[model samples]
Target: MSFVLLVTLTVIEIVLLVLVLAIMVTMVTRQLRSIAANLARVAFGVRAVETQVSAIGPGVTEVNRLLRDINGTLPRVAQRAEQLAR
Candidate 1:
């Protein structure tokens, strides 16, 4: 009788362990799905930012070229000012 009781308890323990493992796996799967959804949102935002930056690139280059032209004329303007002062 004691042997039979021991066997029954062992089977119950195994069944409980299996249930615990299944619950843990389910929780992990839910968290992974949540992470995947958030990552997709982040990717979309990054693409939008990239598009805005690309649109600005040509304007920035034009501004830089204009500034360079202004800088080239400054030295001659300074020389003319010195001559006038004399």
Candidate 2:
């Protein structure tokens, strides 16, 4: 009698433990899927940024060249202005 009751209780406990483990596994699977989707979106966004930067590369170089030209002429313009003031 007591032995049968003990065996039955042990079986119930094992079943409950298995149920709990299954629920945890299901929740973990869902969270992993969510993380994978977010990572994919981040990857796509990074690719778009790379494309835009590459497209702007030539314009950036042109602007830098124009700035250098302006910088070179500024000193001569300042000297001319000084002469005019004198």
Candidate 3:
């Protein structure tokens, strides 16, 4: 009789431990899914920003060229102004 009671208690303890482990696994799985969804959204936003930056590249290059042209003429203009001052 004593042996039978001991076996029953051991089985109950094992069942409770398995139940607790299952709950923990389910909670972890839910959190992982949420993180995956947020990461996907972030990836989409990054791609959109990349597309916009690519579209602006040619305009930026044109502006830089214009600035370079102005920069090249500045020294001659300054020299002329100095001559006029004299």
Candidate 4:
């Protein structure tokens, strides 16, 4: 009789432990998925910034080249105009 009682109690304890462990594992997996989703969002933002920067490159290059050309000839042109006026 005592042996039967001990066996039943041990089985009940094992069942409760398994239930608690299962709940804990489920909670951990859910948190990990949430973290992964947040990281994916951050990666998407970085890619968008990269694409926008690349899109602006051609316009920026054109502006820089235009400034360089104007700078190289504007002073000489101004001197020629002054000489002609005099």
Candidate maximizing TM-score: 2
Candidate 2 pairs with clashing backbones: none
Question: Which 10 consecutive positions of candidate 1 have the poorest summed lDDT?
Answer: 51-60
Write down the lDDT of every candidate, Cα atoms only. 0.98, 0.98, 0.98, 0.98
- Between 2 and 4, whose TM-score is larger? 2
Our model 1 lands, by Cα RMSD against the true structure, at 3.7
The parts of candidate 1 lying over 4 Å away from their true place are 64-86
Residue-level lDDT of model 3, residues 30-83, one tens digit each, is 999999999999999999999989989999999999999999999999999999
Off by over 4 Å in 4: 55-86
lDDT of 2 by residue, 1-86 (tens): 69999999999999999999999999999999999999999999999999889989899999999999999999999999999999
**Pairs with backbone N, CA or C atoms under 3 Å apart (clashes), candidate 1:** none
Best-first order by TM-score: 2, 3, 1, 4
Give the range where candidate 4 is weakest over 10 consecutive residues by summed lDDT.
Answer: 51-60
Superposition TM-score, candidate 3 onto the true structure? 0.67
Candidate 4 per-residue C-alpha lDDT over 1-86 given as tens digits, one digit per residue, 9 for 90 to 100: 69999999999999999999999999999999999999999999999999989989999999999999999999999999999999
